[model samples]
Target: MDFEEDLANDSEGALLEGTGKVASNLSDREEILQSLDSIHSQINQELNTIGQAIEHVDAEELPNDIEEFSVGLSDYGAELSQFIDEYRHNLSAQSEYFETLSSEEADFADITDGIENVNETHRAMNAHWYELEDTLISMQEILANFEMPTPQEEGE
Candidate 1:
């Protein structure tokens, strides 16, 4: 019989049931870890692009009143870049730990520990992202308050 049928036919005590559950948990956890890694990479790439854009902004070209806003944007971008680096480091370490668990027969405790680690990292990343979002919103409001020069006045 197939593995699923074998598992279903097992009339043993709770041991078989527990084993099947652990196997399922491991599979699900692995998929989540993989997805997290992919997301981390994408975020890092986008942050890099933002950093580049910030660097390209010409402070001298901005109106005197808005020059400070540009500086604040640069500072925020730098802080975000640093945070992303730290998050990536945490993700890499967790990935390595998960890899080690996979190489051996992990017990329930080990699986649980790995899952907890992933959850904690996710929480930390989410918190940092929220902070960044708030900063961006503030910047957007500041920009919205600035008066744009009319195209007809630009040539004069």
Candidate 2:
């Protein structure tokens, strides 16, 4: 083969190799997308369950309940916020890794879609969390304002 023909064959070979890589990347992207979808669904389901539980709570007044109820909610909110912060940090790292991978592989371009799905899920999670926090704070405030009736006042 002449020099030009040899160079043309080498270029064609490189293109085929790159094509193989792209196909493999596409398969991997599909798997990642499936996993993200599953996670999204699971998060939504769990949040729904939590919402249902909160909705069904029966509030009743009891002796010496104010102090314990306020303290319990404060502690629970702090712990739950810490856990969610850690989870979101991990998710941010995962998104950055996927973004880098997508930039490197042409066939992995769809990875951004999966990442966006995760972002949407995260937003929904945060919304629910914040709503719960607000509700807890409001409950605490309401409890703080209550003055237990003295025996004389109760009798009247």
Candidate 3:
């Protein structure tokens, strides 16, 4: 092939490779969002279950300190649940943004902008995840301070 033809062919190959990478990235992001949705659902379910259990607890039978602890647990559970819901909402918004970008006949600059938005979303998500992790660790510490009676002793 002539030099011009060879250069043209190389450019085409590179363009195709770039497009392929973008498509792959889109697929990966979709998968991550789906997984997040699934996790959010599971967390919501567990939180609801815990709330139900707390509701069933006989408040009058609990020691004053334990009763106060139960209230705190319920409040924290509610706050955590709200945070999860907000995270899921943000994910949905990001998904919609991606969908809009993908459906458009975007140029390189538009695609670059989309990628930047995705990166920002990722950073925000990571930060939120870390915050949640820290909150969970704190909750664990709080629980560690509490002294629960053994089942056998409770039966006495």
Candidate 4:
């Protein structure tokens, strides 16, 4: 082949290779999107469950009864915010290939950090839930005091 013809063939090969990579990347991104959608739905469902559990709770007494209920919720808010930040970082880190996206070098680091952050959030949320349960128990005890009338009242 003439020098120009050979050069033209090589350029075409390179273009084809790069186009393949772009297509592969788009497919990997779509998979990542699907996984994220499932996770988001699961989290939303869990949050809804928690909301339902707390729905009938009397919050009017919560301000006075639970010393740190508001503070605890604030801390939970911070943890959730941090989780979102890490999740954004993780999602932006995409793989170059469609087949091996999870193990790929491009996304491994961010994914690791994101998983850790998510794990931490799970732990924090669990602790907060227990804390809330304790608060509810205490409130129930306060309300239960009505079962025992004072001796003076009984005598009267």
Top candidate on TM-score is: 1
lDDT of 1: 0.57
Candidate 3 lDDT over 1-156, as tens digits, reads: 232242244345422332334334545766765675565566566455444444554544444465455555566556556655665666556545544444336466765786687678678777877876686677678667644443344446
**Which structure among the candidates has the greatest lDDT?**
1
The candidate with the higher TM-score, 3 or 4, is 3
Question: What TM-score would you give candidate 4 relative to the actual structure?
Answer: 0.29
Candidate 1, 2: how far from true, in Å?
22
lDDT of 2 at 26: 41
> Which residue pairs clash within candidate 1?
none
The per-model lDDT (C-alpha) reads 0.57, 0.49, 0.55, 0.44
Deviation from truth (RMSD, Å), model 2 = 15.5
Indicate the worst ten consecutive residues by lDDT in candidate 3: 1-10
Per-residue C-alpha lDDT of model 1 across residues 60-155, encoded as one tens digit per residue: 533565545545765775676666577667756654554445443656687678768878987987898798779867767866766534333443
lDDT for residue 123 in candidate 3, whole number 0-100: 86
Give lDDT for model 2.
0.49
Off by over 4 Å in 1: 1-64, 145-156
- Candidate 2: tens digits of C-alpha lDDT, residues 1-156: 332242244344322333333334444655654554464455455444334333443233223564455455555555555545555554555444443443435343455565576678668767766875686577658657654433333335
